[model samples]
Target: MGVVRAAGAQAAARLTARACRIAGRGATSLPGKVLLRLDPAAIGDLARRLPDGSIVISATNGKTTTAAMTAAILEADGRSAVHNRSGANMAGGIATTLLDARGDIGLLEVDEFWLDGVAAALKPRVTVLGNLFRDQLDRYGELEAIAQRWRVLAQSTVGQLVLNADDPAIAALGRGASSPIYFGVDDSRIGLDAAPHASDATHCGTCGTPFVYERRYLGHLGIYRCDVCATRRPAPSVVAQEVQLDGVSGSRFELVIDRTASIVELPLPGLYNVYNALGAAAAAHALGISMSTIVVGLEAVRPAFGRGESVAIAGRALKILLVKNPAGANEVLRTLSLEGGPLDLLAVLNDQIADGRDVSWIWDADFEGLAPTIGHATCAGTRAAEMALRLKYAGVAPSRITVCEDLPAALGAALDAGMGPLYAMPTYTAMLELRRELVRRGAAGDSFA
Candidate 1:
């Protein structure tokens, strides 16, 4: 009877997927939603079908890109991974990926809030916890709450853990595990003198005392130590050293795996991407993949979805950078600041349920740094006026800021009105909408599973 139910759920999911494809809609989450509705245990059942066992990646940011990088690394070794590459990362999304399973290994990026449930069911062979940040407070509550949940997940898991040592919240989870692989940045040249104001997890996880930063990177991620408990950033076995970031084009860094080092020419911009690459390399190393293969695979990877993804429209290029919270936005803004020039930007802010609904995070981001670089700013989405106001306060003149509630019109104007490089910064839901509009205009390709 149980076998029959499982078969029935898979068949239903397949049918829905077929219909979705026929209807020209991308195969994303609706099929998995139906599958889970039919059989709640469908994820575990399908995950077990993989011969190489499963791997799960969870974080507030960079999970999708990290998962994509990992998949690329495995593919370099002639192995394939069934992944949630389109960024539908909930339970329904996981179920859909399994329903359409075609590879020996299952690589998934699970949502931060859904990590415990998904990990409990899949029991992945290698679980990667990158970092934790204050995101979507209306939905996920506090950062402490998510860290507590991750601690529980880490304790319960029997698999090997791969963690970011720079993040105290993530590093603390290793206390309960037998042996965890820790990865972090070691180069001081790329470090910030002080942490950003939007930085979360400043205090020590063990004690209530605040942490002292030796070298701060994006947000609270960097070298630091607790004066009270003496807890410090773990020396990462996998590290990116002597980093050099080039605007928009890419970044070059030496990927040091243990004592061996290889120069990595990553085609993605920003230091945040370097973190993603290191995490992916560490996870792949835990899975027995060689460092040489990891380096080759990482160099071959492109930006995932709206993350530093470039699209050609009207004979000009439009680069999309998805920013929802302060930390992520700061990194994007910092990257843009690296290219010294007048910039044309189309900023979209959405207050949908997926985007936290509370738009207070915009004020928390340090937009003042890039204010002088703005040539013209076209604000769009549900909270267009609010974004324009935020930019105004950040030092962008009122004459330079234009609010357009319509996304298509705003994008068109930004493209036609600009002479130099154009950038589109949008929240989660806004990215989807922008992509859909681009697809309708034949500017971008459809997303796949």
Candidate 2:
């Protein structure tokens, strides 16, 4: 049975590679969909080929970034990992990633809904659980429902659960386990004292009463202690301290892992990513990566495409952010607000097959908070005018907003719109479109091959 499965997987990978070549597309999740046509267990088949088992990272946000961090730590420690870095969270994405790797360990970023089935099949050596907030309400339903699903899945996985202790939703999970480790940030300098409007996870997962927070980082992620019955954020087996953000590009922090001390620099940005770095660091330590090797690998890492990724754009630097849902979009806005100066924004909206067919999530995003600070705004994509209208209602001065239905034209107009730095926030498919346009205009690197 195993021999037959290996042969089948080999054939599938070859066929998918051929399709990608012929279609002139960068490696895509569509290949996985192709494999499913042959066998639904195609991802599992691919995973079995990896010798050192795997680690599965899943959440509504930060899966790709977190998985990339773990893979970097592994490679630094001399173990290679097959990963899905293109935001393909389905079974097919998993299949394609595994088939591409020549490594023993598989590091995968999976969708929240796919967790139960994928976890059962891969039987990973470790799993990392980041916080869960309401994202894509139409598709994901509610935060409570998704957390319930994770709890059910955790009950079955035999490996260790590296959970985000600050998230009450995740803190409530993996309770039966005696060996799970938690990783969270403890730097008071970077902590949020009171919960913001975006904050969730206030109630005790154990007691249902509102929990007290010792600190609040973006969106209910921070140190917390329950007063009613003593439920609280677990002290991390690994914790990040003295965090220092180096703009939207990178950060440095001291990681206390299993009692050893090491300073690490991450190639990604945002306070959210600090938690991601800690998760990766803790999980790597559990997997036996030396602190020195982990440090080397993390510093060598680069941002995954469209997630705080910066590229040389026609002699100037442009940062790309994929803003698909509300919670994430709001955080990006908050991050930008800290700049304390005029900012340029390019917001692209598309109601396409890959981007959620519904674009209403834009309203839920706190665009109003982004208005006063937006010195120049250029809206693009097929729904550019729609986005402009939305921004106008959000208090953006109409005079400062420009709508360019043509992507190339919009990007150029946006780049020239404002005086300060440009922030491009596009939806899932719109981001792809913008990338293609950048390629056409000789604005982006041809590293796709």
Worst 10 residues of 1 by lDDT: 188-197
RMSD (Cα, Å) of candidate 1?
1.3
Candidate 1: TM-score? 0.98
**Candidate lDDT (C-alpha), each:** 0.91, 0.79
Counting clashing residue pairs in each candidate, in order, gives: 0, 1
Q: What is candidate 2's local distance difference test score?
A: 0.79
Give the alpha carbon lDDT tens digit for every residue of 117-176 in model 1. 988889899999998988989999998998988988899863889999999899988886
Residues 197-241, model 2: lDDT tens digits: 555677887778887777877777877788989887777778888
Q: After superposing candidate 2, which stretches have Cα over 4 Å from the reference?
A: 5-13
